[model samples]
Target: MKTLYIDCFCGAAGDMLLGALIEAGADYEAISKALNSLGVDGYTLSCEKVNKHGTMATKFDVHVDDAHDHPHRHLRHIVEIIEAGDLPKEVKEASLETFRRIAECEAEVHGTTIERVHFHEVGAVDSIVDIVGVHLALHQLQPERIVSSALHVGSGTVKCAHGVMPVPAPATVLLLRGVPSYSGDVDGELVTPTGAALVAQVADEFGPMPHMRINTVGVGSGTKDLPDRPNVLRVMWGDAVGDFHTKESITVIEANIDDMNPELLPPLLEDLLESGARDAFITPILGKKGRPAHLITVLADDKKVSAVTDTLLRGSSTLGVRMRKEQRICLERDWKHVLTPWGDVRVKIGTYKGTTSTTSPEYEDCARVAREGGVTTREVYESAYAAAIKGEYKDA
Candidate 1:
């Protein structure tokens, strides 16, 4: 599968992300034409090669006309502008999702509804271009998966419409919920609201760069002079090396509880999955004193370990939890919808080297159909499985 990895060594911003995509071989004219097609005027997009410290990188800039100075805009207005624009369906959806994330954060920070929240910096014409153009560039790349490293949010304070605020700004910090990030050595605002929203929207997994065969690398330089490190973001285009299905990492967290209520274990498992655990379950075991106990195990990616671990600790009576990192192999898989006698059921198809290896019905869909049809879930599963095996399932 084709994959794109973002390396935020210094930090990221809207312009910086676009620059990286351009450096990674995105068509600049096509992106500009897309922005123009939006029917929003008074801005020009420009790119040039520049030196950041000793490394050469591309610098992206948006020059907006003074005549189009509208500093504040409501979330609904921004949504309407995007919906009316002439853009690819995928581009429009991705752009709208990013903007929605920003609005949600702003609303939470200001204690207001999303519609009532007023956007200052992010609602500007230049920011609109950056966010929409970034999605357009991503659509051109056609990556099957996108991964990113832990973000390096800078230190110190930044002045915004809300006056002087701590580094990572209020909106930025809120958007970074569940994202892995840390303050860098630099003393300034590194991750902007636009950058935070973009990354939070696009990135599928976050941690160290995964193992892949490098095809190309792009360096996007931010327009800032820092005392500690070069202000730049690196993007890499590549494919998985060796057996693509064999390389993956997951953290296994386990805790043995003897005092927790047995009835609460089910809800704890649900909480763990809701908190981003890949999987969670409990196994009956015996404690040291020969008492019956439960062993809670949670499987999660490295980025979600903290959140999942917290859930495990808070929901269980265990004093300590053990953790071990393990590698897992998975088959390439996708979903399909099968038309059953009663309704459409979702099926999971696993493939290996262009051949189907396994076919199974989605349990949630089967359960729902069974409840409505007054039948057993097993019957629904068998029907869907047969349909999938006979190549009778249609793509949803």
Candidate 2:
């Protein structure tokens, strides 16, 4: 699968994302033409390479002519502008959703209803261009998945239309709910409202850089240069290259239990699996005094680690559970049905790259067919394997 990882060490803005995407191979002319079709007046878009500290990056600017007197618009006005544009349907919907979220945030911040909210800076021509251009660029790139790093929301107060407020303005604060963010070393508004909204809308997951083969790296410069670090956002376009599988980080929880009944272990395992454990098993171990103990181990995704741990603690006689992280690779798998003389057996096909590496017939299907045919399960399995090898499966 294709992946795009956004490195927001300096935080992200809409213009920065657009610039980085364009540099990462999104067609600039397509983005420009799409924006021009909107027929919004009094603004011009330009992109150029610039140096920030020592790293060269693209600077995307939307120069708006204030002399044209663009009016402060409401949420409905912005929605109308985006709806009238000739762009991708998904792009229009995403842009509209972004504006709606901002309107909601603003409404909450100012104690007004969404309909009564008046957008000041966000309704301006530059912000509109930045937001629309970003969606256009992302659509052009067409990555299968998009990931981002934790945002570095800078410290210190920022002066806005609402007067001096905290580092992340009220609207930005409201927009970045549930997203991983921190007060960065540089003191300024690192993440803008438009940037925060885009991140919330587009990023599929947030953490460290994912395990992807980096193909192209594009850097976008921020407006201000920071003291200790380069103020730039990086867009990495790459394929999720793997040996035989994709990689992900998982948590392993283990507990030593000698007091619990071995007969109850199966039920405890069932509960753990039901509670979101990827895998659960027990191992025989010698305790400190040579007593035989069962080591209960569970593999879980990060989000489900707590639940798995709770199940281990509550369902077993273990006082505490120890946890650790592990990196695991999973083969891409799909189901195909292979026809046998008795019945159809579903087979799991595991692939690496484009080549099939392994195949396994559904044991339950084989067993059922074996009973009906008065044959051994081994014989049914053999027939299924032969059918699979003979390409008896209907679908790929």
Candidate 3:
């Protein structure tokens, strides 16, 4: 599968993401054409090759005309602007999703609703172009999946429209609720609200750069001078290996809790998943005091080990947790559509040793079909499986 890995050692902003995409082979002319089609004039986009520290990178900038003075815009206004644009549906939706996420997080941080939230810096013409142009560029690359490194949020306070606030800013912190992040070796706001929103909305997974063959590298420079590191974001585009079999390392974190309320367990599991745990479960156990207790375990990547551990400790009534590294083998999997008698069902096909090893209809698909056809979900599953076995679908 086509994959893009974002190395955010210097954190990400919308323009930085755009620059990286262009440097990684996305067409600049195509992006400009799409932005023009938006009909939101008064901004000029440009990129130039620059050297940061010792690494060459692309620096992207959007110069907006001072005459165009739409400083603050509501969520509806931004949505209308995006919807009226003539860009591709994917570009429009992706851009809208990014803006919407920012609006939601801003509203939550400021004690308002999405409808009432006002986007200040995010609503500027330059930022609008940066956000929309990013989606346009990403559409051209067409990576099947995107992964990112933990964000370096930077330290120190930042002065913004909302007055002086801690580093990462309130909106940025809200957007990065579930994502893994850290304060890097810098004393400035490394991550802007726009940058945090872009990654929070677009990234499919967050962890270390996965195992893959190198294809191309793109470096985007940030407009800053740091004492300890170069201000740049690196993105790598590559193809994940074939053959369907893969092995990777993961961390298993476990804790025993007997005092936490049982009612809170469900939300704890959900929180763990949202916090990037591959899996989380609870097992009944007997504690040292002979009291019935629960053992909670979470499986996650090494990058997420610290964040997941913190979540377990805070969300549950546990003072400490145990963790260990383990390896897991998994088959490469893809979805296939099977035409059943009642409806079309999605079947998961797992490949191992370059051969198809397992086929199963997605339970959610089966259940939906069963509900519509007035039959048992098992019937839908059996029919879909039979269809797969009979090669009823072309892909099957």
Candidate 4:
């Protein structure tokens, strides 16, 4: 599997992330042309080689005309600006969701609604370019997995549009909630609000670099060099170095519900899956006072745990959910299409050490084909299995 690892030993910012992506193989000219159409004006994008301490890195820049005249934009305004241009659906949606994440954090910090909370630094043309550029670059790279090292959020006080605040400003702190991060020895604001949102929301898991055959290493320079460190963000792009099985840390959320109507459980499960949950199920249980209850168990990527937790709390009778980190081993899985007598059936094939270990025909596909062909699902399944056997499916 193709993977991208973010090394935040120094820190991360929107520009830094974009710079890393560009240096890692994202097309800069394409990103520039896309930004030119982003509807927000008065900004020209540029990238150049910069020396961060003794090492060289790419520095992404956005030169905004009349920087003082830029408006403090609200969430709606920023959305309009992003929506005004032609962009890939994935990039556009991801970019919008990122802004929403930031806006939500800002609203929480300032005690205001997301719609009413106006962005100060984040609203500027330059920051807008940085966010959009980062998304565009990711779209271009199309990595199957994005992992980040624990963020090194610098220490000490820093001044921002919100006045003097501690390192990791209020919005930054709120954004980094539940994310693995630590304050480094540097005394300054290393992770900006945009940086925190980008990394926290984008990375599926936070830890040291996973096992991978290293490819290109892109170093992105910060605004200024630090005396102790190189002050650069490194992006490692490579293929997963696995023994056909991979290990990952997942967040498991569980809650016991006895008060909510039983009919609501299915839809809640569906909602959880739609909101980034990997698996969501309910099991029957006898609760306090011997009341019949359903135990809701949710599994999700570390990045999606917060949304899954919210869904569990607000979408069900459970007042709160318990979360725990658990490591899981997964086989290398891929899909194969089998031509059944009734119709085509999709088969999920799991492999280990380059050997096919298991195959499961998609029940929904088999059932649909059976229904269309006026046959039993069992017959369809058998025929699908026979066809797959003849094809001798191989690992993807």
Candidate closest to the true structure, highest TM-score: 4
What are the per-residue Cα lDDT tens digits for candidate 4 across 80-181? 988987887657767887899899999998898999988899878878888888989988987767999999999999988868999988899999998999
CA RMSD per model (angstroms): 10.6, 12.1, 10.3, 5.7
- Reference-based lDDT, each prediction: 0.85, 0.85, 0.84, 0.86
Give the residue spans of candidate 4 off by over 4 A.
Answer: 243-245, 248-329, 333-351, 354-396
Better of 2 and 4 by TM-score: 4
Clashing pairs for predicted structure model 1, backbone only: none
* Model 1 lDDT per residue over 109-188, tens place: 99999999887889989899999989998989877568988889999999998899999899899999988999967889
- TM-scores, all candidates, are 0.64, 0.65, 0.64, 0.69
Residue pairs with backbone atoms closer than 3 Å in model 4 (clashes):
none
